[model samples]
Target: MKTYHAIQELEATGIVTAGITRRHGGVSRVPYASMNLAKHVGDDPNAVATNREIFFKQSRLTALHYCQQIHSTRVIDVDHTASATLKQHPEADALISAQTGVALGIFTADCVPIFILDVATPAIGIAHAGWRGTFAQIAVNTLTQMQTRFGTLPTNCEVHLGPSIQKCCYTVSPELLNQFTERFGSTIRKGTNLSLQTANTIQLTEMGLPVASISVSPFCTACRTDLFYSHRAEAGQTGRMLSYIQLTTKN
Candidate 1:
């Protein structure tokens, strides 16, 4: 599979591959615009299915496994067969797998989509973290699952925080901001701006992963409407971009 231009940092790793798709490469129009991979967002299902096919073909992934994503910290284990039945999988905010040829997918617009791959073991994980999920420590849960299921150490894992709404463009209500501060302490800042990226990083660091192994995308979906979808910028009327990663086998 040719590397996606948007996820150049992830491609540079050589060992694992990932992509944060843009809004240009699919067939959806207006509202959905293009490249809408989510089915529940009111986009045409046929368009979404075709878009998914294009994405899989472009990424060279065998199958795409997606979670229902309920803004919680639940994580599931996926294998080849599991990937095929992703439509029926329970609502989870994260997924982990040690099996090859299994692609784990997460959808996000303003929410964060994080991908983790263990260099020392054959495990991969994906997490969907909105403010709710971030405060719930979804990233930490994903790392813990990798450790427990595959015996992968946190230090051996490298994580990529895919494109999402950054703090600069992510504004929240005072009440919501206070909730974050109350739960996460100083991580939410005194102002009403809650940095979900920083919060997730701190959570992962607390789980024993080094800061150097974590790579965060600087592109904010709300700020870069030309390239990504933004739920807040569009007043919850936009489509979702998908961040996907998988362990592919050598044929």
Candidate 2:
């Protein structure tokens, strides 16, 4: 079985590697069911470690820096010299880095795995955007951090919203729907179903990123349990897919 779904648009930039791991080809069982990359979940530690080993070996990525996600809008800036220490994962939902050979990753099941590549500055960012993070505008905050730290321009960025729970299955409460509607406008909600992808896209576009530069995945995690682990569809018991992007030492 395949180990991941590569983001071809980002990889085509020829200076980065981007992809999201799939739920197959590992040692996780039942709820996680193989290839689970997150440790915070209830999966066995050995299994999660083995799954990550399998993914790293297959992806040929040497280092991974991910945060302890809190569903907040916090963004972390990873310096080029960060690999020297064994620091605990920062409590954040987004990560931006300009370092080569280091991959930035985020875990998600139903939430969106947002990939940001500032092709001009050659920086990369990965954000985990659930309803809370989406409402908090985590994606835009990531770009803003890149702008401040790396002089990254919105027009030079190419973003990818990886596979996640879409509106077709992302039904929410009326109060929550009203909150999203008020912030992101009425178009972001379809009945009680909120479109987190649309909300993130709308925010990114408002940040001056070209509409054509953003690419959203068609795979809805909740709708495709065969290919992904969906927290909503699986009743909150599931694995997480790792969406990652790395800057390479090339043009």
Candidate 3:
């Protein structure tokens, strides 16, 4: 079974390794089923460990730096000195790094996993964008940080919005929909369903990123439970998939 879905556009750059894991090819039992890489979801520790090891081997990644993921717009910069294990990670929703050989990861079941690759600066960022994070503009904050820390320009970046519960399956409250429409304009919502993808894309484009520079995955976790784990579809009793990106040490 395939272990991951590569972010084709990012990998095409030949400077980074990027993708999200599929819910197959691992030892995780029912609910998690298989290929679950997160340890905070009540899955067996050994199972999670084995699954992560499987990803590292398959992806040829050795070092991993991930956030604790608090559903906020907090973005952290991961430098060469930063090292993190599953048990020891910072409390944030996004991570950016210019350092090679270290994978920046985010755990998500139904939230959007935003991947940013600033080719000019050779930096990478990954963010966990749930509704709250999207509302607060986490994706924009990541780009802003990249600009400040690494001299990254939005035009030099290629971005991908990984699979999550898209608008078709992500119905929100009327109040939330109004808030999104007010912030991102009315085009981002259909009735009470908000498109987190559009909300993020609008902000990114407004910040000078061309619309063509961003690619969004068509897959919806809630719609395709066979391929992904969905918190809403699974009633909060499912494992999380890991979305990660790493800069290759090779020049």
Query: Residue by residue across 1-251, what tens digits does model 3's lDDT show?
Result: 67999999899999999999999999999988899898889999999999988888888888888878889888888765655444336799999999988889999998999999999988999999998998899999999999999999999999999999998989999988998888889989877788999999999999999999999999999999999999999999999999999999985
In the order shown, what is each candidate's alpha-carbon RMSD? 2.3, 1.4, 1.3
Residue 43 of model 3: what lDDT?
93
Provide the lDDT at 135 for model 3. Answer: 87
Model 1: per-residue lDDT, tens digit, 43-147?
Answer: 999999888888778877777778888999999887535556245368898988887777788889989998898977768899999998997889998888888
Off by over 4 Å in 2: 84-88
Minimum summed lDDT over a 10-residue window in model 1 is located at 1-10
Per-residue accuracy of model 2 over 169-229 as CA lDDT, tens digit each: 9999999999999999998998789999999999999999999999999999999998988
In each prediction, how many residue pairs overlap at the backbone (N, C-alpha, C within less than 3 A)?
Answer: 0, 0, 0
Q: Which stretches of candidate 1 lie over 4 Å from their true place?
A: 1-6, 80-88, 185-187
- CA lDDT of every candidate: 0.82, 0.91, 0.91
In candidate 3, stretches whose alpha carbon ends up further than 4 angstroms from where it belongs are 82-87
Error of 2 at 79 (Å): 1.9
Q: Estimate candidate 1's alpha-carbon lDDT, on a 0 to 1 scale.
A: 0.82
